[model samples]
Structures are given as structure tokens and as C-alpha cells.
Target: MDIHHLITKLREKGHKITPQRLAICELVLSSKDHPTADQIYKKLKQKFPTISLATVYQTLHLLKDLGLLLELGFPDCSARFDPNISPHIHIICLKCGKIEDYETENLKEQWAKIVKDIGVEPIIQRLDLYIYCDKCKKNQ
Candidate 1:
């Protein structure tokens, strides 16, 4: 995502664009792997010595509330943030903690059906599949 576009959107939402928030946005935009709040804080701390963990959490929540991020939740792990806001499937490796994003027409249809059955419009829909990665399966 373009930094300028993000700034413009934030401004349009009545949010003040601060350096810390901008840095967080950049990190999320550039990240290929979904990162947890602690991971984001650690990366930001290298350049911003005084950046607090609380600030990172708050910024993440703010971004999520603004529909700029997707929060991935797992039963046994911390929630990770994804910058890709589009409808997609998350294939997660249960053993190695690897997460991969994929898109399938079949799943999209199924999701649509489920949503229709529920009779409510959702802001976002999440679909996750958990399995061991190839390496982990081979190791076992």
C-alpha cells in the first residue's frame, strides 16, 4: 500500500498521523508474514528507542477499527495482524506456526452461503485452516 494513500485515508477518518503510527503502518504494509504486537514493537524499537508496547497495541487496534488491518486469532497463540484486508484463506501450520494466505473460488462460495444463512452483514469474514506443514509432517 502506498504511504501517501494511507496518510490520506487516516486524515479523512479524522485521525492525526503521528510518526509512531506512520512507522507502524509502514511496518504492517511491508510485512509478508503476519506479525504479532510484540514482534511489531520489537522491530519499531530498533529505530524508535522510546516506542512503547502499549502504543503498538493501541495503534494496531486503531488500524483494525479503521478497516485497514485484519487480526488473526489462534487458540494457542497471540493474535497476528494482517495488512491484506481482502477476503482470503489462512492456511496455518499447526506445528511450525507458519501462516500462508490463499484464495479459492469454492471457499468464497461457501463463505457467501454461510453469511447469507446467518442473515447479517459482516464487516469482515475470516476462514482459517490448520494443518501441519510439509516439513513438520515429514519430521513426524
Candidate 2:
């Protein structure tokens, strides 16, 4: 989690990076789990008790708009924020509510072909392929 580089990148995008916003960015980038704004607020509270939930939400949205974060879908509820914006799939555990990243490069061509055949330009949206992981299956 290189805060300096992230700040520089945000500055390059003409986004002002305040210290509060930087703290929020640090929390997101350092996190492995795709956390919601509330989750981020809870963690940030430890160090920055005065930081408001609305601020966290605004920062997350801003970062997502800048293409530096991914807004992941939730089948049951609110969206989750992911720092990794790179093209990849995600698997969510139904029981424990765990989120894991799944990387595959083979799907690019297939997706492109599908878009071509459909004759509609499709923006390759964030892939969320839900499946029971090995641990979840074993528990089941």
C-alpha cells in the first residue's frame, strides 16, 4: 500500500488529496477484504475518530469514479468497495460472507466475441461470479 504513489496518482487526475481523504485511501488500499463504507469507517475510527461516515462514502465514490477502485455488487445488500480496479472476478462466500479474488486471463477473448456477436458494445463490467469456495463447501 503505497500511499505516496496513490496520492500522486490522484493528483495526476486533478483530484485534491486531503489528509482525511488520504487516510481513507490508505485504509482501502491496505485492506484485502472488499469493505463497505461502514466497514471502512469502523477501521478509520480507531485512528481518526472524527472522520464522518459521509466523508468515507464520498471518498470511496470519488476514487471509484477515478477508476482507482471497484464498486462490487452484493446479492443481499449494499455494495462493497475494492481497491483493485484491474480486470478480475470475485467469489463471495454465502455463509461467512468472505470475498476472494479470482484471476483469469482467458476470458477476455470470449467476452469480446460475445460482445461482437451481440452487436452491442459492452463495457467489461466488474465480474462477480459467486460460488462456494473450498472451505465453504467443506463446511457445508
Output the number of the TM-score-best candidate: 1
Model 2 residue 15 CA deviation in Å: 4.6
Error of 2 at 22 (Å): 0.1
TM-score of every prediction relative to native: 0.85, 0.77
Give the poorly placed runs of model 1, Cα more than 4 Å off. 105-110, 113-118
Stretches off by above 4 angstroms in model 2 are 1-5, 8-15, 116-124, 134-140
Tens digits of per-residue lDDT for model 1 on 1-140? 58898899889989898899899988987786898899999999989999999989888888888788998887876799998887788889989888889987786788788889999998877878899999999999
The C-alpha local distance difference test score for the whole of candidate 1 amounts to 0.87
Give all candidates' CA lDDT scores.
0.87, 0.79
Instruction: Please give, for residues 1-140, the per-residue lDDT of candidate 2 as tens digits.
Output: 37777788788878887778998998897677899899989988888878999999899988887777888767677888888765667778777778988776677667667668989964436776667778879988
* Best of the candidates, lDDT: 1
